[model samples]
Structure formats: structure tokens, C-alpha cells
Target: MPALITEAHDSTRLALSSHNPGAIEDFGLIGHKVAALADLAQNYTNSAIDSSELNRLITEHFPWWNDSTLRYFPWMRWPFKVMKDPSTYLKMLRHKVGIVIPAGDGNARETAHLITTLRNVHKCKLPIDIAYVGDGDMSPSIRAFLSRLGTNVNFIDLTQVFDNTLIQLKGYSSKPFAILASRYPRTILLDSDAVFFANPDDIFSMYQSLKETGLLFFHDRTVENGNTPVRQEWVGAQLKLAGRLPSAHLANNSLFFRHHIDEEADAALVAVDKSKPDTYMAMVFACWMNTKHVRETVTYQRLFGDKDTYWLAAELTGVPYAFEPWSSARLAQEPLIDKGFPLVAPVENNLARGPAAQVLEGASKPVSQASPTIAAEVLSDEKEAKSIKLLATDTSSSYDKNQTTSRVEAPHSTNELNFPRSSHNREFHDSPKPITPNRRCTTHMVHPHPDGSEPLWANGGLWLDKRDRGLGLANWTHWYVGSRNDEALKTFCETSLPTDSPNSKSWLTSEDGEQWHNEVMNTQPRWYSNDWGMDAEGCPQFEEWRWQSLNQGFRDRLERMIEEVRKVEAAWVLELG
Candidate 1:
């Protein structure tokens, strides 16, 4: 096995130096070089890969590729570099409101637009000390715009703190590093397109308890847009190794964090290096911070889209925050100035009881009635068969006597789920018993058993370990919980089977639910997984791929079913808070 890798402590170094051992310099020379190469790759990939240039280069001789491989380029030094000297940054009276605008011509139009709007139209009450992080001197227009704000706005040029290689990266790079390493104890990083609707000075005081360990980030309202495809597999593998949860939501526009004296700050920067398509930097940082225990608290609020940002941050950090009133939007996309801005204020912080609680917002949900106490069975009555079976287990003393087992009914919609009354009755059992071959059955007409047995189950259960064990149902406990879908497959597999267990059954069921047997299941080995393997703890290394794949299948059926059900039950929301 390869040596156990760990995060870096140096601010200048990459998160995982082992990936580019030759690039390791006196400080972070190698990491910087790799970042430069990544910048180069990003440019090439964006330009050539996205257009005719790729075909042109591929069909003809492209000297760029032949000139030097990415790994060995004579690295260029960053121009207008600003060293991270906390003393210089510390000179500020209070927090620094940092904004990064990446444009080709070094135009600060976005910066100018945001600040000018905040100063002129909104007339923000908060005394804004802006840290403009970008390249080149501000254009005359930007300078003139700042001059209007005068002493009210102390503009600091932080274009130097970021590496020169990152100038072309076209994403959030070194922003976290700049924020975390800044002289200010706290920082609120905003995108260039942000327009403040109100004074956000109180955000820092909202959750004083979490102000130390947890970084505050606004969750993007739309998480379904998906994440950048690059480094997803690699980051997923790292999170699994670290035993951290995949961020439920992606944070893009707004982030709040305090400078800390730990490896987590540096680690966030490294995560940037390790991953590509920097759109989801907040998520990547959340995962890294959670793994490193960098932040002890993670507080999310409905500051972004309805509750999108709040839930997404909650998903990644496993932390929770109450709904607040201070709401801002990217005017670039949402021209909602006519409708009045969303509100944001300090609300009570509520620790998520568990994963389910995080996702059960606004959507009225009853108690999860699914319990492990009543074992499930399959009974095929020639005339009638209620999806839940009553077959006897092998351990049962009397196989002839099929007990009338109490079973939970699948809700027509997620909101209608009737949970068990007892608090001790966990919504879904973390460790479910493995399904015996005889018990592994489905009811859906579309999904038949791989052995050609009758399909009896309907509630979208996960494939346990993907091992033969008759390819039996492993953990059906999570059929009701929406939050469990992504992590359920691996969690169930890790609990029910041995780490080294190889799938013995060639005839397995499909995750997509189109077919039950090997015809479909054999073809789809969890979505992105290339092979089946496990660590000592029984957790699959590439569980993200499988989880994503399996959940997508469930969502395909569940989402449509949900929409139809919601259309019918739309009036029921009047009862909710």
C-alpha cells in the first residue's frame, strides 16, 4: 500500500505533496508549479478542449503539447505578488470584506459595480473595509468610484497575495487562503457580482459560539446543477479516507470565515490544488475542514436561495444554523431589486439532530414509521400480495408458520411519511441485517430477481455489498429517508459485509430499477465505480460514485413521483410553519 498521506501545514504548499514529489521546492515551489500547470491545463482545456482548437491541435501538429509536458514546465513567477504578512493586513481596524473579480483585461468593473452600488444606492450602514483581490491597478473609473466613498471605504490592493499562475485559473483560488491568512480576525468573502441590500455587519455577531470553528457560507439555491466533474473522484476518495460526509450543497457566491491557527486554513488552499473546475470551492473547503476538524462549528442560514445555501452547508459540515433575515443576491442573475431583497438576521442555531433533520425543511414530514423491530418478509398469495412479505427467516423455529409481520407503508410523498412515535426508534437503522436469499425479493413489475425469481420489493432499497450472498437485500432501512440515499449504499455495505468480501453473485439487481436481475444490476456497478473493493472498516473507497449513481436512479423515479404527488397535495402546505 502507498504511504499514508496527510494534509500540509505550510500555507504555500499543496494539500497532498506526494502527487507531485518532484515539484516540492524549498517551501511550496512544486505546489506552485503544479498550480501553474493546472492553470495552463485549465486554459487549454477551456479554450482548445471546448472548441475547434482541440480538433485543430489533435489533427495537426500542436507544438504546445510537444514543447513540454505540464509536469516539467519552467514555472513562471507571479507578478504583483503580495506576501501574506498578517501585520500589514492586521493594520485594519476590524474585519476585511474581501471580493475577488477575475476578468481577462484586469477590468475592475464588477468590483466598481458592487462597491458603487453599496455606497450610492443601498447606502449600506456597515462601515465597509474592502479588500479587492485581483490583478493590476484599478482603472481610473474604479479609483474615481472609490474616491466618492472616501474614508467610508478603505480599499486595500491584495492582488499580490495570489500566485501569478492563478491569474489564468478562472476560478476561486487563494481566496480562502487570503481570507484565512489575512491580518483581520474575521472575513466575509464575496463574489465580484454581489450587491448588498442591507448592512451585513451583524453577520459576524449572529453566532458567536460558532464564530471560532465554523466558517459561514451562503448555500447556492440550485444544487442540482451538479458540481464540476474534474477531481470529483479524487476528492470523493479523500473524503472517504478521512471519514467525512460529501457536502450536500454547493456554496459559490458568499462565504464567512475567521482566520484560524491550524492546518485547516492551509488545507483549504490545498483542496483547491487537488480539485479542478473551481466552481464548488466552498464544498471542497467544507469537506477538507470537516475532515481536519479545522472548524469545530459549521452554521448555515437561508441566506442564499430559500433554504438552498443553508442545507447545502449543513450537509457538508454536519453543522446547523437557524434561518435568519439578512438576505443578499447576485444582481447579475437575479434582477430582483423591484421585489425587495430577502431578509437576514441572527436566528437561533439548531444543531441538526441527524442527516434527516437537515433535509426535512419546509417539506412537512411526519415521523418515520419504518422500524427494524418488525422484520420484513415476502409472501406471494396467488390471489393477493401486499408488497411486504411474511416469509419466515432461516433462523425461525417454524418455517411453516409465516408470522403476520407489521410493516411500514411507503408514503405517497416524502411529506406524508409517518415516523415512529418513539424518539429512540431511529428513522433508519445505521446497521441493518443482511437480507437472506429467500427474503431478497421485489414487487415492482419492472424489476425481477436476477435468479429470475419474482420481484417483490418496491421501496428503492440499496444493494448491500454487491456481493453474491445470493445478491440478497442488505439494508432496506433507508427506503424512506431522502437524505440517506447518497451515503446509504456504502454505509449499509460497510456494516453488513466484510471489507475484503468479493461479490460472488454474477446475477445481481439493477440500481436503476428497470430490471431486477444481473441483466441490469451486473451492468451498473454503482454509477462511477470502476471495480468493487473495500477498506478495513468495510467502507468502499469510491462510494461516492456508487452513491451518486444509485441516488440518481432513485431520484429519477422518486422526483417525478414527488412532483405528481405535490401537485395533488399542494394545499397541504398551509398546515406548515
Candidate 2:
């Protein structure tokens, strides 16, 4: 129990001794209420996920698909020269090549383009796996469109299998992958937005490395934008409401590689039933394992340089990889060259010449290429030079005659040059349009009093009658010290006053006046009254006096309490580790 409870109970008894028996009983009731609330918090801290039910739930919801069309691909042919003691699992036969596609609603065009590009890369070879794990109803048109492509594609509709489970767990959509990891260990998880610019041999390499670790985590650059707090608080609220607290914190949407399934994974699935299932169960698994295990077994690796660097390393090193936003420059220069543009095309030329030049110039920008402005001028000159050459060929006979030759200058106009007038006009006219800044209102309105004498209902205002004011102050004092009988204070303040009672000013000198005065002084003391006086104690000297010594003692007690809670929290962390 908290020390605050004991201190509050003793203080309330001493302060309310002169009150009626009913009032004393009310104070005791308040103490009981506070203790009950504390007990609820403790129970929540100790709750955890049930493992047996979780495993059953996962197996029950597994999706069904056409087995004939679905081809299980093996990673046997991958270059394994650098690996030490390569697993025999990688050398098995079947489809050696596979493409992983993450599917969602209304992304058929992008997915189609991705498939088209992948088909182009593989040159009509290798099987493709289209993994769809979202909840929106998709049209048959999109499904048929993808199937029409020559590549073998498998659509894993997560919604069909886990319909009931997803409905039960509102936020945790990542459970399917957790279950999938244990069932189909070789499958790759891809993001819907990912585009394949080059061959994906590096991706397979990362998967091999991740198989050694129990789990793999990706780093998201946007994680710093308060996503951690938002997710943690979201999970924390669910835990608090379900009488389970202190779950793990992890980001969703990053790639994860799961090597083995254990008790902690099952526990996480149990928790998923109580709330919206998260898209990434690896995070929840990490949190649950951390709670129950002794050593950290989970591995978190970033996929890209800075953001993409780690991902790149993991891919190159043949570990399980995660995806993040990457710059266009990361793509291989070969594919860009094959399409037309040289390996090193001038950046300026590509920008000035537009998409046509971009396609012709290839993936890399050349070192000797002119700037956009210079390239535009050079291109214009080249066009004019070509025109001159054509005109010379047509008029060569006329120039060779001995007769007096007349020189004719051709008409030159901006329109005739075919310069982009609309683009130029837009650049000039649109440049001065001021960016509309977002407006924010920071003012807060205060509620005013009807009588309007310093807003009597305002803080420190004389809104209540004298007796009511005293009761109000006393009630606040009781609660601050940790008492639970707030009803008694409310009753005392609502009681009527005597008809012939003198004005509030006269009560300052009466017998009860002296007592009330001392109460007020004790409740709201001056800064100069404390041991430190004005120099150290800012205001309310009595509180400052109590705060100095009491705060240190409170710290010591809280430290001990926290240490005990840490042991409970650590149980989950240890399990995952």
C-alpha cells in the first residue's frame, strides 16, 4: 500500500475530531475508497496473455487457397559462397525464384506495374507470390487483372481466414504474419508501395540471416514523430481497461522475419483478442518475450542506409530485411542503362530535356553534363543549327551563281521556336502566390459570474456563504491529504446560514472568527513564515515547510514501490529476450 494512504487517514482523524459523528464516519469512508482504487491499479499491473487459447485461435483462422496454382519456392540456387555452415533448408528443390507483393484495397494499378516490372526483370521466369493482408473488400476485376499476367501469383486473402479474429482484436492485424511465420517459414513480406528497380537477389540473402534470429525488426524514419507515444498509450489504455498493463512497445508496417515460435508468441496472440490487432505482431511478441525471458533473443535491425543503410547491409549480408523510404539513387545503374540512358547522364540535361531525355539518359547522371539552364540553351542552339543545315542543303545552287545574291533572314518568334509558353507563363505567374500559412487560435475564454463582483465564482471569490466556504476548504484539504469522504464536505457546504448573521467582514473578530482565521493561515500560508522564508520558499509557506521534508521521504518510498513494480514489468521483457 502507498504511504500516502496511511498519512492521509491519520491527518483526517486529527483534523475532524471536533466534527459530528456522521462527519467522522464520512471521513473513514473516503479513506476506504482511495484504498480500493489503488488495489485496482495493482491487479492491472499483474495481468498477462493466456498462451493455450492464442495458439488455438491462430490455427482455427488459417486461410484456404487453391493449392494447384500456389507454388512453394525454395532458395537453393542463391550464391552461398560466403556463408559458414549453410542450412540444408536453402538447398531444397522447387521454384527457386519468387516475388513478394503486399496487397491492399484500390492499389491494383501500382501492384500491376510492380508485377509487370518484376516479370520484365525475371524475363518470363520465376514464380510470384501476391500476399494480401488487409480488410477491405476487393473487386474481382483487380484479381482477374493480376491473374491474367503470365507469372504464377498466389493471393493470400488474410481477411477471409481471420474474419472473426480480426473483428475481436480491433487494432492487431499483424497476428496473421506471426502465425504465418511459424507455419510457412520461407515466405517474404513486402510493402505495397515497394517498386522493384533491380533483381531481388539481395532480399533473399537477408532472409537467410534472419532465420538464425528469432525475429527481425525494421526502423522507420517517421518513428520520431510521436508514433512511439501514440502506440504505447493506445496499447496501455487497452491493457489498463482489460486489467493488463506494461505491454511491449513496437512500430507497425516495418518488415519482420520470424525464425521460431515460442510461448511468448502465443501469449501475444491471446492479448490480440481483447483489442484491435496491431498490423505487426512481432512488436507485441517482443514485448511479451521481454517480460518472460532471461536474455534478449529478439534482434532489431534497420533496413536502409541511415534509414536504408541497415536494410541494405542486411540484404547484402543475407539477413532478414525490413523496408523504409529510400532515395531513387539506391537502384542499380544497369537497368537504367539498358532502357536507353547512359550510366552517367547529365542531371541538367535530364531535367531540362524532360522525360524524353530522362529515359534516354539512363539511371546515373554524368559528371561532365551541363546545368539545366546551359543544357536548355545548348539544345535550342542545336535545333537552330539543324534548321540551318537543312536550309543550306535546299539553297546551295542559288548561292553558287555569279549573280548578285540577296540575303534573306528567316522570321524568328518565340511561338515558332516551340518553346513551352504555358510552362514559362506558369513559372512567372505562380511564383508570387503567397503560401497560405496554417492559422492557430490559442485564446481560451473564461466563464464569467452573474453578479460580476470580481467574478464571485472565480478562484478565491466569495461565491459561497461563510459556513459553506469553510466546508469547501476542509473537504479539499481532506482529499489532498488522501481522504475519500467527499460527500460529507459537499453536504456541509450546501447547508443554509442564519438569517441575522452579520456580514462576512464582522466574522473576522468573533470567537469562531479567530479559528477560521487560523485555518485560512494554515491552509494558505505566507512565504516569509517558513524556515527558508522568502529566499527559498516561494509561496504557501506551510506547504513549503511540509514539502521539503515530506518530498524526500516520499521519493524514498516511491523508489521502493517502483522497484517492486519493475520486477513485475521485467517478467514480460525477460520472456521475449
Candidate 3:
């Protein structure tokens, strides 16, 4: 049995009131000295402290740390406590890690797109070792693409580690599990649809914050205005019942972490159950981690998709995060060259080719592989010039022709044109363009869906048919009037369009109106493809100037269509009749 010893510290000496030979006899005055160490054995975590610091700090107190008996002692695990080779701790922290899940059929195409773009278009500068977790069958395209991308990618079949029980519980949805399984101490989990405008290395700047908190996430908004946060109490109740962390709304899918969620991981399956409504797997488990309180965390704003899941994660995590109103530009359609107007041509129609095809096709090849003749093909079309504006506009005003030309000059090469440099600067210029009458008439200028689908035109608004009827109206009103109000035309821009920002003016100028609709809207999902409630009669006629200026002629034609639709709806009866 060990004897109890009283420890006392003085200016030069440490004295024990009572003695315990086993605890202190080995080091004459080192009992207090050993206690001052950073406790790597019990509290091993990622940090700059290496074996040198460990040796320096320990040797100064107990110079016999390397003694065969002292070194092998279970209690004094030393530098190996944190890392087997403590010298490599800092180097491990710098190794880029990508925690990716290429699961589900929908993600197959997205997986190909991500790897292809990251390697070719975005040109990821970081040396990321992508650790993919999913069934091997789920990502054949991704695998093929990865082979072309060279040796930095890693593929892990879920069956290799997880037993049938965990795998059957829809484990593919558990982002935390996938993250924990990665070999890297620090990992970044990005969604498949995530498009990168810049190098992913920029994300490493948050490494300190990630290391400090052990976890970090981003905040995001919806594609249109349809997303509204669910009741906080409801989200809390679901999370608490399922054992998760309570969040404000949703946590962005783009997660960065220095640790993994291995403890009680099996219990986390309850969060991913398909039966539970609004129970997002990532949000549920992240919230659960918060309850454990072993890790520090922070969150910031970055744009993303899947609002319900992402928003719930943000709300439950309750980490300090930033929110940016406009952080990215989205994909849009290019008008058909022969038509001399902006139009979303059908994907199957050979004659309906647009510059967008060139952007995607050329994006897969390196800058040197592209032909100058192919680049000229993009610039030669008059409509391509307008499409380039959609890619780079800041505000609604007409884009500078010179600026648009410069941006589209080398369409075959991703490096030459930054693509989204915002051709229309957000500066509100003075223009006496008529508002309501012109806006109403130009409804014909609204481009048809790229795949020959008709838009959901109903009740004074264009609906994308996203089921949330208000979303269609809100989106159209925002584009037409430049305000977020559901009834923006009736409220914010009631009398006339405001010239300032939404807070001050609450309305959009003709230029401000054009930039978001033509450029930004194209980037969102389904807008350019869906056929929402179209008759066999086909889409509206094309007129470029009407869409460009919102002139009086376009408004007159659109008003007639609005009246025609109202008359048909009023005369028609329900299916019972």
C-alpha cells in the first residue's frame, strides 16, 4: 500500500510533509516538477508541442525520463501518449483531408461532377487525400474519374469496417460516422453538389478555430425564399428525443472537425431513421455530440443546399457562426445563338446549343488542351455575350460590353475568365425606365425551361412548382421588384421601385432586376429544367429586348397572358365536377 504524502512548494524547494516512496523516491525533487508537465498521457490532443518540448520539459525535472523503467512506466506514457512519433504531430495537422461519401444514386452524377470540377475547373490547389465512404457500386463514375485525377484519392468500402447491423441502419446518411472513420486527425466533409469558386486550401485558415473547438460548421440560406425555419421547440424535442444537440435552424453540410464521433455511435442511428420527419442524420448526431460537452465548437456562414438539414444542424450546434447575404454565384442557361434572344433551349435539340455546354465541356479539360478556335466559338455568338453577363453580373444594370467580352473571351479555358467577376456592378444608376407597366408587359420575355418544359404561370406570378406556392410568387416578385417580401409588389415596391438597397429603398431598378433573374436564378436547382404545369401549346415566344429593358411593349403582352390564364382557371371546375 502507498503512503499518503503532503506536497509543499517554496521559492527553491518542494517538500513533502508525509512520505510515499513509490510516488516520489525515484526523483529527489521531481514530484512537483513532473506535475507541471502538459500531461500528454491522459490529455493527449493535437498541438504544436513535440517530443523536443516533452523531452526538454520532462528531462529538466526528472533527467532519468529515458531510464528503461521510467520510460516504460504505464503512468508516464510521455510523448507517445499524444502521438507515437510526436515530432510528426505538426506535419499531420497540415496534411489535407477530405471526408467524402459517394453514396446514393443521385450522388453518382454529383460525385463525378465534384471530382471532375475540383481537379479540372476549380483546380483544387491543396493536396487533399479524398477518403470516400460508401458502397463501391455507388460511385463507378467517381472511381473512373478518380483514376484520371491521379494518386491523391482514397476509396473505402463501408462493408470493410462497419458490420451489417450498422450498415443496414442507413449508415450512409451518418456524416459524423464517415468523418470519424477517416485516418486523418483533421477532416473536412463537403457535400457532393458543392461547387468550388476558389481553392479549398482557403478553408485551412479555420484550422486554429477547428482545433480549439474540435468542431465547426457553416450557415446557409435556401435557393429561393421558400425555406423557413421550423419551430425551435419542435426541432429541440426531436433532437432531445433522438439524443442530439439543439440548433437554431440548420447546420450547413460543409463541416470541418479535428476529432471524430466514435463514442455511442451506434446509438446515433436513431437520428437517421427515415420514419422521423425532419430528423436529419448529420444534425441529429452533431446535436448529440454537443450534449457530451467534451469538445469546443464554432460555426460561420457559407452558402449551401438542402436547407432543412443544414439549418437544423446550425440551430442545434449553437456554435458562433457568420452569415453572408451573397457569398456565391450559381449556374445559369445561355441563350440560343440563332434566336438572338435569351432562351433556355431544350437539352436534346441539337439546334438549341448554347454557350453553357461549352463552359461545362471545356471545364473538364486543362487550359492547354483547349483550342483557340473553340474559345472563339463561344465569343462569336451574340447571345453568348449576354449569357456571359448572367455569369458575372453584380447588380441589375446592363453589363459593360467590353467587360462581358473580356470575361467570355477565353471560354474554353477556366483560368482566362474568372467566370463570375460580376459584370453588372451593384451601383444603382439613375434610369427613368418605367416600372409596373413595363414589368407586366415583359412577362413574355421570361425564358422557357431549357428542356422545353413550360413554367407554372399562375395568379399574377411565375411559380417554379416547388409545392410551396408562395415560393414561386416570392421568387418572381423578388426578381421583378427586388424585395424579399412575399407580397413584395404590393408592399415594398407598392407605389414605385426603390433605388437603394432592400433596407433603405425596398425596390429594384431595371438593371438590379435583370442581374439576379438572368444570372443568379440559373444557378439554382430545377429552374432551368422543370416543366411546371405546361399545356401542349408549348412555351412563350422569345423577345430579347423585352427581357433586357423591361420596356412597355413586353409588359403589354405579359398582361394579356395573365388575363388569359385567369379566365381559364375561373371557368374550369374541380375534378368532381
Candidate 4:
């Protein structure tokens, strides 16, 4: 049982209460001590004492924390209750942590590209923390190189924060720990290979509010029909094994224990407010799922790395979380005009076209990885400069030739590249004439928001397809768009989980019934590659920009991102010298 003690000075009746024996004893004297500090503060405010005198008063009362924080003092640390080796706690109090990126040698080049993009292209003012596993993955020379890539980039070694006994950053493990090691009260974790159409800060607007739920997660591609009984059976058993009740959130989940649902939570970007209690507890579960034993034994085997665990942990802890309404979409470079601008109707795109971004920078490199304004290849194409821009840009606004280079245009449709449509380009103009969109071509998993608000970013770097990584493939332009919810699963959840059956409350389930569980376990299942939706004719969808929809912005941004990456690549080569 816990004892309760009250603060003498605070008017709202604050209490010092805890079930932990150490907490009770540690905080028992805190209220009175704080009350005395309040009097001392009042005396100083009233000019009753000098700064030295106030210092003396504090020194007289609390000697242990006098030099630490109460005078200059650590909050939620010190005096009564001491924390266990809280390495980053004080760092958190001092620094404003913004975007947290977990980098290693494989993704070092991509991470450099990302940092450069944030500073130069996105103009992200938020401080960035680049966390790596250890010195083995990111050497001192590499760290020095990255440190010079952009401003306000801080490096954190994950080993110092987490026990080496519990984690090993091979495979799909480092993503979760990066968030766990963040010094920010609110953490925004992004993979190193990620690129943005909008500034990094603005993506938060896509969420309803971080207040109601301290976390926001995006769903994975809903590209396939739900026929995953093997995985669903495991999910149901995991929920039961953990003693989790079917909370309203999971009870009506479209994926959990259901056969016809697609994957959940993309995890390209994870936004969490660690200051909230619910988020704190939920984070514990998330980290646990990513730990060695659990992740190796089941999590990685069943789910796609750390992607689905964010939502799974949140639900298991019963902490509310929000998801973006739009389902995911895949982007690919438009085929050349000579190569065929528009495909024959009803043809599927290439299977190599889909898979989110990832950092292959396994070895950190020199700082020159800073993306400059333009690429050498683009600069070399000066003869075709005006011609390329004629296709990519509408008006020949005299631009900074030094910072900008001519783009190489794929011979596209006549109506494509018709530009100067103002930033607000929702209104349509068909004078040049638009191609009839193949209805089947508007596939799901190819839509991301980035209109007036610039609400889009992607994990894969400037590759048309990630498979040809490091081969310098062009950015993907033709995107598949459209998404749908599982209406059938919603109906089934209502029918199968009956609340009136027994002693149930707050939800439909009156018992830990296995009826729905059995059905999910017995259904036939199928596996899906990320590029499963490319079956619809994916031929050069954005060859010509549509007046009503401006995928044109993404195409333009892609050019800029590629240019920056080239600059960084040159810098890295120079470092080898």
C-alpha cells in the first residue's frame, strides 16, 4: 500500500504518493523542502535578499542538489528519489530534439543525403539527432564527415543508451531504439533514406491532434486482399498470450485476426510524444517487441521488421494512436516518350516498382555527402538545358543557373509539362487535351498527399526502383493512387464478437471467445510482395501533368533531391583523397 503526503505551499493540493517503497521514502520530505524554496524565492523577488544570499539559502537547505539543478537544477531527478543511470535525462532537458534518424555504415551515404535535403531543400530548422549503433558501424572519421554535412546535426551512439546484452543492431532492430534513445519530449523518428516533398515539420498537420493520442502512425500498403490466416492466427495468439483484452481499437481492427485485411503501419515516419504517460508505457512494449529474443523468435518472422510493431505495441498497452486516412501508394519514374508515354489499357506496371525507402549506408562516409544544388550529370546536359526545362517547367523564369541545372526529360505526352498553373493548381485546363486515364491503372498504394500544403515525403531515395540502388536510376514519376477499407471485416467484427453472450462490458466480447479466432486461423493465406499492385498498366502516368492534380510538384522535387544527392556523392569521393 502507498502512503499519501501533501505539498504545503501549492494551493491545488498536490500529493506525494507512490506504491514503491523507495518513492514513498524519497518524496516524503520533498513537499516541505519545496515549500521552503518557495519562501526563499519570494524573499528574493521582493528584494529582501541578494543573489548570493539566495544561493546561500539554497545551499543551506539542499546540499546534494545545490550544485546539480534546484539552484541550476535537474527536474524529476535528484533529492528524494534517484533514477537508475538515466544517461540522456539531463541531455533531454538541455536539448530540443527534433527528427531522430538511426544511421549505420550501410545507410551513411543515404543519411548524408537526408540531412543535406533537410537543411538545403526542405529548409527544416528543427534540430536533427543522427543515432548510430556503435563506433564499429560509424567510425570517428565517418562521424566527423557527417558532422560537417549540415548544421545542427548531433550524433548519438545507441549502445550507450541501451544495454548491449539486450540488443544487437543487425537486421531490422535499430529503428525502434532510435526513438527510445531520443532526447526530445516528443520524438519524430525517420529512416535515413527518407526524402520529403514538403518540409519535415509540416507532416504533423496530417494528424488529427497529438493531444488525444500522443502517437501518429501510417499504415502499410493495403495492396493485397486479406488472405493471411497463418499470420492472423499468430497475431490473435500473441494478443491472448499477453493478456490483452479486445479493446475497442483492436476489436474493430481491419487487420488483426482477420483474413482479408492488408498489412498495418508503414513506419516510414513515427511521431510520438514521450512526455505522455500512455506513450511511455506503449514505448516500453514497442522496444520489447524489437528486442533480440522476441524479434528473432516471432516479430521479424511474422511482421515486417519494426514497421507493424509500433501499432501492435500501442494496442497491447491500450494506448490510443492515430493513422493517416490515405492508404500508401508507390511512385515510379515515367517511361520515356520514345519508350511509350502511355501504356495499352489494363496492363500492370513492373513488379520492381514498389518497396519503401531504406538506408543502405552501412559504413559512414566523409562529410562531402552534403547534397549540393545540382548534379554533375545535370550540369553536363547544358545543351539540353532549355529543352529539358521546357518539358519540366512551364515558363522560362530566369533561374539561378549556378544552383540549378537542366533536367533530362523523358519524351512524355503532349499535355504533360504544361505548366505555370500557380501554386493552387486544383482548377483544370484541357486545351492541350488529357489522356483518358485507364480506370484499372489508378491502383491502390500509389497515393500520398502533397498538394497546396506540400504534404508528402518518401523513404526510398531518388531511385525509380530500389532494386537498382546505387545504379543511379531516375526518380519514380508514375504513381498508383486510390485506397479502400475492409467493409467486410467491419461487419464480421460486429457479428462474431457478441457482447450479450456472457459477462462482458465496454465492448462486444462477453468472453475470451475463440469463434472469430478459429475462423481467422483456419482461412487460407497468401503472401504479397510490396509491388503486388503494379499489375495495372503503370505506363508513364505523370508524363504530362494533370491540371486538376499536380503530381508535377513531386516530379520537380524529385529532380532537386537527385541533384543534392549528387553533390553529396562528389563530396564523399573527394574525402577518399
Q: Which candidate is the best by lDDT?
A: 4
**Candidate 3 residue runs with Cα over 4 Å from true position:** 1-84, 87-91, 94-96, 99-101, 104-106, 125-136, 139-145, 167-174, 206-230, 236-284, 287-577
Please give the TM-score that candidate 2 achieves against the real structure.
Answer: 0.29
- Residues 1-577 of candidate 2 have per-residue lDDT tens digits of 2355445344534533432333211212222222222222222221131222222222232222111222221111223462333344334321133444545544453455445544543243445555554445345555655665445766665444334332322122322332332123233344333332234433334333233332333222111121232333333333333233231111212111100000011111011110111212222222222111101221111111011222221222222332211100100001111111111223343334433313222232221232334543544555533322221222222222221121122113322211122322111111222211111110111111111111000111110111221111000000011001122122222342123542233553466544433332232212221232221111122221111111233223322322222221111111111
Instruction: Give the lDDT ranking, best first.
Output: 4, 3, 2, 1
Q: Per-residue lDDT of 412-525 in model 3, one digit per residue for the tens? A: 222211122333332211122122221111111121111212221111122222132211111121111111112222332333434444212112224644432333222211
Query: How much lDDT does each candidate structure score?
Result: 0.25, 0.26, 0.28, 0.49
- Candidates' TM-scores? 0.31, 0.29, 0.38, 0.60
Error of 2 at 543 (Å): 52
lDDT of 1 at 518: 17
Cα lDDT, model 2, residue 39: 27
Q: In TM-score terms, which candidate is top?
A: 4
Provide the lowest-lDDT 10-residue window in model 3.
Answer: 256-265
Q: RMSDs, each prediction?
A: 24.1, 30.3, 20.6, 14.6
Q: Candidate 4: give its CA RMSD in angstroms.
A: 14.6
| Weakest ten-residue segment in model 1 by summed lDDT | 257-266
For residue 188, model 4's alpha carbon misses the true position, in angstroms, by 0.8
The segments of candidate 4 whose C-alpha lies over 4 angstroms from its true place after superposition are 1-75, 78-97, 223-227, 241-257, 337-447, 450-455, 470-473, 484-549
